[model samples]
Target: MNAPMAVESARSVATRFADCRDRRIAYRELGSGEPLILCLRFRGVLDSWDPAFLDSLAKSFRVITFDYSGLGQSTGEPSYRSEALARDAIDLADALGIEKFAIAGWSLGGLAAQVVACLIPDRITHAVLIGAAPPGKVENPSEPIFLERALKPINDLEDETILFFEPASPESRAAAAASRKRIEERSADRSPAVAPEIYLKLLQDRAAEDAFPDIDGYAEFLANAGIPILVITGDHEIVFPAPNWFALNRVWKSLHLLVLPQMGHGPQHEVPEMAAEFIASFVRHRSKSQPA
Candidate 1:
């Protein structure tokens, strides 16, 4: 595990906004170099990400984190559908005058990352998915317990551990505690959590078919995009199981996987620095095959 770089902590970064079409998107950025836009998880606000993870990632790239419209500190309507979520990232990029960049998404955000790649393949340099569900049918779908736990309006550390980390493992539980503390370190410019009424309906809408997006030819796009993708996941993730991805070993041509044992959906929380390293290394080393 590497120590977080001496760069500014995510907790203190100033939140900025860009006028993307009808709405203003809330965002915070750190580091320097390649622009890396990160999409949030389901019901995740700008403050939801572990600062340790963001701080570590800042060492290698210009990490930009943002809140989807109407969900956090941003304005306008919010939709959980993959396409709408994808527009959030793309619109923000245009608003910020960014021509090309890498995109990373966690869990549900991963769906949007893939969509962005398809929508603007010429502009996306790379795509990194952390605990994200793959496109199309999964051989191992998510368990029902996720919705049961996720529907809650507020989550305690225990709820977070069960939902994102492995409660069954003492090591994971400890990591969860530390991760939670780091997430709470941000006391300023934090976005409010999505209300239960708002998120419950969103979750319910996505309950069917393991909450995977219904994009046409999504799987085919990945097989053909030839964009460098790095999937960092945990072995014990219940919601988006690793086995589902393993079954498609022959599907992705320029894909790489990192499955950590005794971990769950949020490997970035369990091993923030290590996961960040993996992401940075993947971007630095992967040979890109741009579509001709």
Candidate 2:
């Protein structure tokens, strides 16, 4: 594993806003720049976001990240469909008074990112999809035996640990373990029943079955727009698996795929500095190509 990068000593800003639908969205804001980048997690609360990762991006752009309505601090009952999740992102952006912005989503958030990009292409200038797929079209971690057990009420913690980190590296394993504890702690306050229902609903809501705005064949969308895209996966990510990215590449050859060695699913938390630098570079280059 690479050494953790030291984060800049900038104070992180936090906020809460009501979406058009009246759902309360909680977010953290830091740094300043054009194309206000929106960071959304795969399947956790905004607090579960890695401060180090946010700090890394804050150096280059105004980063805004928030929790999906059903998860984290966002208020509302969870809905499993990608369209519902996508609406939350759009409404959250509108609520924040943002019209155009770059968006990067990791894991499930990546799925949401794809939906948003297609649904509101004009609003998204650039997109970064990390370890995520457009529902139904890609493999899901829920199929794994380990993942099946891990998704179980409280007992799934150990399995989640095994799937989330690189077992070969103690540091990676340790990080995953720590993250598991934090997620578990966050779950403590909510009824255990809520999480399982959310996960099941998300799994069943398959993005492919739903109508999304920007999807015209994933590869076709990228090629036609020549929009900047960064598709990355950990060399050892067992959850999403590396082969899935090949499917993505087949559609978008220009899609930059970086298979980081000795990494796992939670790259943002495991190596925030590396992720930040990569995303920062993408956001900068794309911002420069367009009229300011």
Candidate 3:
């Protein structure tokens, strides 16, 4: 009898494309549609996207996923400015011949998305933020809790996984274990120019730096930009809590919120169906009413 096939969980497919001046950036593309949704993760590589999450979203829209330079397959060791990352996202859209689309980002990518929207508001139709904070600025969590995460040492996979979730359930634990195994296997095969020290420095800078030029006061930008914005956070999320969403709610015109009961930083990965539904609903509502 033939052996059973291995369950392939990493739905991330690899591709290298020119960002600007023919600079190569590694990315993954799935599904197909108008108003494509681009996903930008925190500090994780393209493969870090949960397969189930991608599979679910792929069923609905053409999703574009990519690794920020210096962290994944992209070739770079130089410290990048947030503006450069934002520019890269715009360049990516240009490369794909997409005029305007929806954008979703988490953590650092969330900060980058804000910059992208501000830089080229004409090119982004809708925006969503999940467990995200302004660069060098965070809300919801008390100062002490924020400091704790900033100081936590992400030396190993186990420690890092815990930060992504809160009160980890059995399913989440199993997913973490499976993902760790895949990361270990993949890391053994290829290495990038990521500087662990640089990553650590970024965490410190994000915590200590009192000002971020591009995204310091995101509420003001959101209120002025006049775009449909959806801010979501897990009720149990430790990174950015529901109050942060509430904080932003005070400043924007067409802002909405979705608070999940038992999700975490990566809601799209931890609770994909819920996230996808919320996103699709947001897009549908906005597209029908607005002409962006």
A best-first ranking of the candidates according to their lDDT comes to 1, 2, 3
Q: Which ten residues in a row have the lowest lDDT in candidate 2?
A: 185-194
Error of 1 at 8 (Å): 1.8
Q: Pick the candidate with the highest TM-score.
A: 1
Q: How many steric overlaps are in each model, in order?
A: 0, 4, 0
Model 1 ranges off by over 4 Å: 1-6, 205-210, 290-292
Query: For candidate 3, lDDT tens digit of each residue in 160-270?
Result: 455555436776666566655554543332325345676666556555444345455554766667667777776666665567556656656667787876666666666
lDDT by residue (239-285, candidate 1, tens digit) is 88888788667778877888999999899999999999988988899
lDDT of 2 at 247: 66
Candidate with the greatest lDDT versus the true structure:
1
After TM-score superposition, the amount by which residue 102's alpha carbon in candidate 2 deviates from its true location, in angstroms, is 0.8
- When summed lDDT is taken over every stretch of 10 residues in candidate 1, the lowest stretch is 205-214
* Cα deviation of 249, candidate 2, in Å: 3.2
Q: Give the runs in model 3 whose Cα sits over 4 Å from its true position.
A: 1-12, 35-39, 76-81, 134-157, 168-193, 201-208, 211-218, 288-292
TM of each candidate vs. truth: 0.95, 0.77, 0.78
Which residue pairs show collisions in model 3?
Answer: none
**lDDT (CA) per prediction:** 0.88, 0.64, 0.62
